[model samples]
Target chain A: MTETTIAAPERSRRANLLRTQEGVLFVVLVAIIIGLSLLSDRFLTVNNLLNQTRLFTETALLALPMTLIIISGGIDLSVGSMLAWSAVMLGFSWQLVGLPLPLAVLICLLTGLLGGVINGLLIAYVRVPPLIATLATLAIYRGFSFGISQARSARGFPEEFAFWGQGQVGPFPTQFVILVVLIVIAHLVLSRTGFGRWVYAIGNNEVAARYSGIPVERVKFTLYAASGLMAGLAAFIFTSRVTTTRADAATGLELDVIAAVVLGGTSIFGGSGSIIGTVLGLLIITLLRNGLLLTGVKGDATFMVIGLVLILAVLINNLVRRR
Target chain B: MATQAGRLTQAHRQRGLFAQQEAVIAAAILVMTFVVSLANPDFFSATNLLDIAVNTAYIAVAAAGMTMVIVSGNIDISVGSMLGVCATIAGELARNGTPIPIAFLAAVAAGGLIGAINGALVAYARIPAIVVTLGMLSILRGGLILVTQGRWIESLPEEFFFSQRSTLGVPNPIWVMIAVTILVGLFMKYHRFGRAIYAVGGNAEAARLAGIDPRRVYMFVFVMNGLLVGLAAVLYASRFTAIQSNAGQGFELAVISGAVVGGVSILGGTGTVIGALLGSLLISLIGTASIFLKVSPFWLQAVQGGLILLTVLVDVVRRRRRA
Candidate 1:
C-alpha cells in the first residue's frame, strides 16, 4: 500500500536542484523576481526592494515563530488577535494612561505574554487542542480590544516611537534590520539547539517525546510565549508604521503567516521545516503581492493571486515529493 | 440496573453519551433563558425569541454540515467563503431574471464544485484538510470580490424574499433548518454511508480493511457541506437587504465553535446532527442572554469565546475521567 502511493518515478536526490522542495522554491522565487523585473521597470530598483522589505517586516517577524510552532506540530491562530490586542494596549497605555513610552511598550509586551500564557495553560495544562483553544482566544482577544477601544482608532504617536518603523539606516528601514536580527536568532535556535531537536521530537510523536523526558509542556509553553512576544514586537512595528492603532488592525494577517509557513515546504502536520524555506516562502508571497500590484491587479485580485500561489505551491511540493 | 447499563451494546452506550451531552447543553440553555428573563421581562417576547431562532437557523444549517465534515475527520473552513460565492451567484442570477430554482441549483452546483476541489486536493493530492480549505477560503472570497467589484448586490427580486416569509406561521428558513436537521440526523443514525463516515473517521485503515473507501467518504462529506452552505446562502440573502462582498466573514469559526461546543470531537467519529443543532441553539441563547443582560455587543465575542473554552474543558475532563 505504501509503495502504491507513489505514482511518480524516483529521481536521484543529488542530480537536480529542482528535486528538493526548498531548492524548487528558491528557483521559483528567482524566476518570479526576474519575471517581475522584466515586466515592470520600477521593480529592480533598490528603493522598491527596501520598501518591500519594510512593508513585510511585521509579517516576517510573525512568520519566524509561526514556522517554529507549525514545525512543532501545533498552531496558534490567535497571533493576529494578539497583535491587535497588544497594539491597542500600546496605544492606550501611551495616549490614554499618560505612561512613559518605554512603560507602554513594556505593557504591550506583557499583554502579549499574558495572552500567550492563557493559551499555553489551556493547551498545555488543561489539555485542550491548540486549534480550539486559540480560536477561542482569537475572538476573546479581539473582543477585548474592541471593547476597550470602543471601536475607535488611536493615532498620533510620538515621532521618536514612530522612528522604530519609519527610520532608515543606510537606506534600510529599522524594521527591516530588526527582522533580520530576529530571523538569524530563530534560525540558530532552530538548527543549533537541543530545544530545536526536542521540538521536532514532540511534533513527530508527543507521547514518545514525553517518555524520552523532553519536557514537552515546558517547550510548548515557551514556544507559545515566544509567538506572543513576536506578535507584541510586531504590534509595535505595525502601529509605528501606520501611526495608528485600531481594533481591526492586522485582520486576516494570520492567513498570510500560515500561507508563508506552509508554502515554505513545512508540513502542516508538523515535524519538518526550515526558517530559510520560510523566508523564501515569505519572499515569494511578498513578491507575488508586490508584483501583482505593480502589474495593476486591483483590490481583491491580489488576494486571488496569493490564494492561488498558496494552493499551487503546496500542490507542486507534494507532486515533487512523490518523486 | 447498574449492571444492566454496563451490559448495554456499544451503540446504546454511544446514544447514552450523546443524550448526556445534549442534556447538558439543553440545561445550560434553560438556565440562561431563565436568568435573562428575570433580568428583562422583554426577553420572553415571542417576537424576540423567534428572531433568535431565525438568526440561528442559518448557522444551524451550516453547523449540521460542519458536524458531518468534522465527524469524517476533515474540516472545511471555506464554508464562509463558499457562502459568499454562492450568495452572489444566486443573487446575481435572480436579478438577471433566472428562475429561483435554477439559480439555487446553480449556486449549489458552484458550491459542490468548490467542495470537490477541496476534497480532491485533500484526499487525492494528500494535502492537509485545514490547509486546503484555508487556501480555498482565500480563493473563493477573493474571486467573489473580483467578480462583483466589491459591490453589494442590491434590489434583489421579490421572489428572492421567499425565505423571509412565514409558511404555516413559521419562517421558511426555520422550516428548512428543521427539515435539514432531521434528515441529516436520521441519515447519520441509520444510513450505511453515514456509518461509513464514522468508521473512516474512527480509524481509516480499519475502515478500509472493512471495505469502506475513506476517500469517497471525505469527498461526499465535503460536497454535502458545500450543498448546505449553498442552501444557507439563500437564507442569508433573505435576511439582509443586500449581500456585500464580505457577507460571511468569520462564519466558519462560529460554525466550528458550535460543533466543538456541541460535543463533536475534532478528532472525529463522534458527533450527531441533533448535537450540532443544540449547539447552535446554545450559541444563539448566549447571544440573546447577552442582549437581555445589557452587555455590550463587543463583550459578546469574549463571552462566546469563554463558553467555547468552558465546553471543551468539560469534554476534556470527562474524557480524562473515562480513561
Candidate 2:
C-alpha cells in the first residue's frame, strides 16, 4: 500500500529551509519574477505590482479557507458558486428589493454562511462525502443565482462599495490591505490554535481524532461554514472591483484557489501544509498571471502556462517527497 | 440481509448494491415522467422523447466512462474541456477536407493522447488526479480559446452530422451511446483488466502483491475515458450548428453527478455503468421536465443538486442501518 491510503505524516522535526517545499516555491517564484521582468519592462514597476495585487485579492481570500479545508482532508467545489450566489444576492437585495447597500452586503455574507452550513450539515452531520456534497451545491447555488437574476448583470454600486475593492489606503489597494489582515489572522489561527491542531488531527486520522475526543464533526462543520463565509466576503470584494454583480462572476475560480493551495504544498490526502506556503503560492500565481499578461501573452494563453505550472509543480513535489 | 449488506463494500459485492440503486433511479425517472406528462401531454410526444434521448445520449456515453474512472478511484475534471478539444479537432479536420470518419478518429486519438498524459502523471509521477485534471482543464480551456480566438466553428460538413444519422432504424447517437455502454459494461463485468481496476482501487498494495499493476489500470482507465469523451464530443458537436468556444462548459458535473447518483461511490471499487446511465437519464429527465413544467430552467441545477444530496443521504442511511 502506498501512503495515499493514509494522510501525509507529521512534518519532520529537523528543520531545513532550503530542503523545504516552501523554500523551493520561493526560489521558483523569484526565478519567474526575474524572467518576467526581463521579458517586459512594465513587470518590475511598483505601480504594476500594486495593481496586480488587486486582481488576486479574491483568490487569496478564498485560498486561505481552501487551504484549511484541504488540510482538513475535505474539499468544497461550490465556493465559486457560493461567490456567485452571494454576489447575485448583493445586487438583488440592493437594486431589486431596494435595501440599503450595507444591508445587502450583510445579506450577501449571510447567503454565503448559509451555503456553507448546508455543506457542513451534509458532510459533517450526514456524513456525505465533501466532494459530492459540494458538487451538488455548486450546481444548486449557481442555479439559484441565475434563477434570481435571470442571468442578468447588476451594475453601478455606491462608491463605498467600490472602495473595498479599488480604493487606496495610503498607497495600498484596499483589498490588498484586507487580505494582509486576514492572512495574518489565518496564519496565527492555523499555527497557534488548539482548533488548528484538531484540524490536522482529523485530517491525519478521523477515526483516531474521534476517539481522542477532538470533536471531529464540529471542526469539519466550522471549517466548511467558515469557507462559505469567506467566499461571501470574497464575492463582496470581487463585486466591488468589477462594480457589477453577475451570476456568472467567479466562474471557474475554484481552480485558481485550489491550484494555489496545492502549489503551496498542501496535501490533497490531508494534513501537512502551511499558510505561509499558501501566500507564497498565491504570490507565484498572481505574478505569473500578471507577468504573462504584461509580456503580451493573451489572457487565454496564460491559462496554459498556469496549467503547466500546476502539473509540473506537483510532479516535482511528489518526486521529491518519494526521495 | 443486514449483515450481508453490511459486508457489501468490504466483500466487493457491487452488483447487488448497484441493482438496488438502479431500481431506485428507474422508479424516480418513472415518477418524474408521469408527473411532467400529466402536466403537459406534449411531454409524452414521440418527437420530444426522441429529442430527450438524443440529447442525453452524449452525457450517458461520457458518464459510462466516468463510472469506470470513479470505480478506479480517480477523477478527471478535464473531461469537459477534453471534449471541447476533441470537438474542435474533429471540426477543424472536417473543415480542412479530411474524410469525416478519419477526422472523427483523429479527434478520438487526440483525446486518448491527452488521457495518456493525465494517466502517466497520476500513475507514474503520483500527482493527485484532481489536481492534474484541474490543471489540464485550464490548459485545454485556455488553449482552445487561443487557437479558435473565441470563435465558434460553424458550417460543418453535412456528413459530419453524427447524431442525425441512424442505423437499423435507431438514431446514430443513440446507437453509439448504447454500443459503447454495452461494450464497456460487459468489459467491466467480465474482463480481467476491468477487475484489475477494482482491485487497484480497493487496495493497491494488495493488488500489487497479487500481480496486478495499479499503474497500468490507472493509465488504461484514463485513456479509455478520454476516448469516450472524444466520441461524446463528436456526437454532441454534430447536433449543433456551431461548436461554441464554451462547448462542454459545466459538463463534468453532469457526468460525475450521474455516476454518483447511479450508486457508483466516489470512494472507488464499486458501481456500474448501467447505474450511471440511469442516473444521467434521471438528471436529463429533470432538465426536460422543467421546460414542460413551466418553471425557470435554471432550477434544473438546483434539482440536480437536490437529487444528488438525496441519493448520498440514502446511501449513508443504508450503511447505518446495516451497521
Candidate 3:
C-alpha cells in the first residue's frame, strides 16, 4: 500500500480501538489515576497503591466470578450475603466447632458452593430469573448468617491465618497475589476456552445456544456455583485480614462488586465482558476511594462518589457502544 | 403471528389467574391466621389485626405504584431510598413548623423531581431501569445521610400524624390506602395511559408502531412511583415520631416482594392493584403469624425469601403451562 493509505488505515485502527469497551475503560482508568495523583500527593506512592489494592482483594475476588456470571447472562446478587455466611461458617467451624483451620476453610468453601448450587438449581431447573432467585437467596443467606453467628462476631484467628491475609512477598500483598492469580486464571478461561465460548453463546441468546447443542442449564449452574465459590474465597480473605467474622460482614458490598463489573464494561444484559476490564475497573475504584479518603472525603461522601462513578461508567459504556 | 397468538393466550390466562391468585392469597392469609390463632389466640385480636392492616396498607400503597412501573416494563428499587429522602425532607420541614400541607406537597414534589430524573435517564439515555434505580438508591441514601448529617429528625407537628386518626371505624392510613387504591384501580382500568403502559410493557416495539411512546409511559410510571413514595413517606412519619437517616433501608425489597407475590410478573405487563394489595396483606399476615409461631425474628428474613421464591416458582410453572 501507499504511505498515505497505510497511514490512514493505521489512524482508523487506533480510533476503532478507542471505541472498544476495553479501550474506553483503559482511558478512564488512566485519567482517574492521573487525576487522583494530581489531587493527592500520597496517591502515587507504592505503599499507598499496594495498601489500597490489598483492601480491594475481597471485592476483586468476587468481581472475577461476577464477570463470568454476567457474561453468561446471569447475576448473583447473593454473593455478598454468601461472603458473610461463609465467613461466619468459617469462624464458627474453627473456633466453635473446633475444626482445624483447613477444615474450617473447606467448610466455608462448601457452604458457599452449596449456596451457589441452590441458586443454580433455582434458576437452571425451575427457570426462575437469576435476579429474583439470587435476590431471594440474598436474604435467606443473610438470615442464616445472623442465625448461625447469633449476630456475634468471632475474632482472634491463628497467626498463620492472619499471615495469609496480611503477609507480602517482596512488597506484593499475599491477598493481592492471590487475586492476581485468580484474575489470570479467569482471564484465560474467559478468552481461550470452549466453556467461555459456551458462556458467551448462552448470554447472547440462550435459546439459540440450546439449539446449537450447548448444555445451557449445566453451564448456568456451573457459573453460579463458581460465583459462590469465589465469594467464599473472598470471605475467607476478608475475615482473615480483619481477624473477625460477623453476621453482617461485607454489608452492602453487593453494590460495590456489581458496580465494579459494570464499570469494567460488562453489559448488565450480559454476553460481553473481560477479566482485564474488571481488574482495571477494580483498580479505578480502589484508587478513587484511596484518593478521596486521603483528601478527607469519607463515609457517605465516598458512597456518593462511587455511585456517581458507577452511573457515569454505565452511561459512557452505553454511549460508546451505541452503533 | 404464532407469537402474537401466544401473547394473547398468555394475557387471557393471566387475567384468569389474576382472580384466582387473589383468592389463593386470601386463603393463604386465612389459613395462616387460623394457625396462628390456634397457637396464640391473641393473634386474632382486633389490635393485632388492625396493626397488620395498617402496615399492609402502607406497603400496598407503595406496591400499587411499583405494580405500574413493572407493568410498564421497568423496575425501581430506589423507592425505599425515595421514601427515606422524602421522610427526611418532610420531617425536617415539619420540624421547622412548615404546615403539613406545604411540607407534604414539597415532599411529593421533591419525590416527583427525583423520579423525573430517573425517568429522563431511562427514557432518553436508554439506561436499564435496574441500573438507574440502583444508582439512585445509593445516591439518595448518601444524600439523605449528608442532608441529615446522620441526625434523627424528631418533634414533628401533631397534624402530620393525621394518618393515625380513624375515619368512621377504620384508621386513616387504611382509608387513605383504600382511596389511593381505588384511584389507581380506576386509572388502570379506565385510563388510556394505563392501557398504554400494558401495551408498551407487553411489546415496546409494537407499542411504538402503534403510535404509543413507550418512553413517555416509562417516565409517567416512574414519576407516579415517586409520588406514591412521597405519600408513603408521609404515612411513615405519621406512624413514627422519629425519622432516622436510614428510615427505609430494606423497604423497597419488602414492597417489591409484595408486588411479586401478588402476581405482578417481574417480566412486566401482567399484574393488578387488587392482587398487589392482597399480596401485601398476605405478607403482612405472615409477619404477624411468625410472631405467634414464636419463631425467632431472624428467621423472618429467610421466610420472606422463601415466600418470594415460591411465588415466582409458581408463576413460572403457570406461565409455562399456558405457553
Candidate 3, residues A84-184: lDDT per residue as tens digits? 99999999999989999999999998998989999989988889988888988998899899888888788888888887688887779899888888899
Candidate 1 residues A1-323, lDDT tens each?
66534522332332233337788898999999999999898888888989999899999999998998898999999999999999999989888888998998898888888888898888887888888889889988988888887778888888888788899877789999999999999999987798987887888899999999999999998888898888999998898899999998988798889999999987889888889889999999998889878877776667787788888988887886688
How high is the TM-score of chain A in each model? Answer: 0.93, 0.95, 0.93
Worst 10 residues of 3 chain A by lDDT: A10-19
DockQ class, candidate 2: medium
Which digits, one per residue and each the tens of the lDDT, describe model 2 over residues A238-287?
99999999988888888889999998988888977889889999999899
The estimated TM-scores of all candidates read 0.94, 0.95, 0.94
Tens digits of per-residue lDDT, candidate 3, B94-121, equal 8898888899888888889989989998
Backbone clash total for model 3 is 0
* lDDT leaderboard ranking: 2, 1, 3
Task: Check candidate 3 and list the clashing pairs.
Answer: none
Q: Is candidate 1 or candidate 3 better by TM-score?
A: 1
lDDT of 2 by residue, B37-134 (tens): 99999999888887788888999999988888898889989999999999999999998899999999998899899999999988988888999999
In terms of lDDT, model 3 sits at: 0.85
What is chain B's TM-score across the candidates, in the order shown?
Answer: 0.94, 0.94, 0.94
Worst 10 residues of 3 chain B by lDDT: B1-10
> Best by DockQ, which number?
2
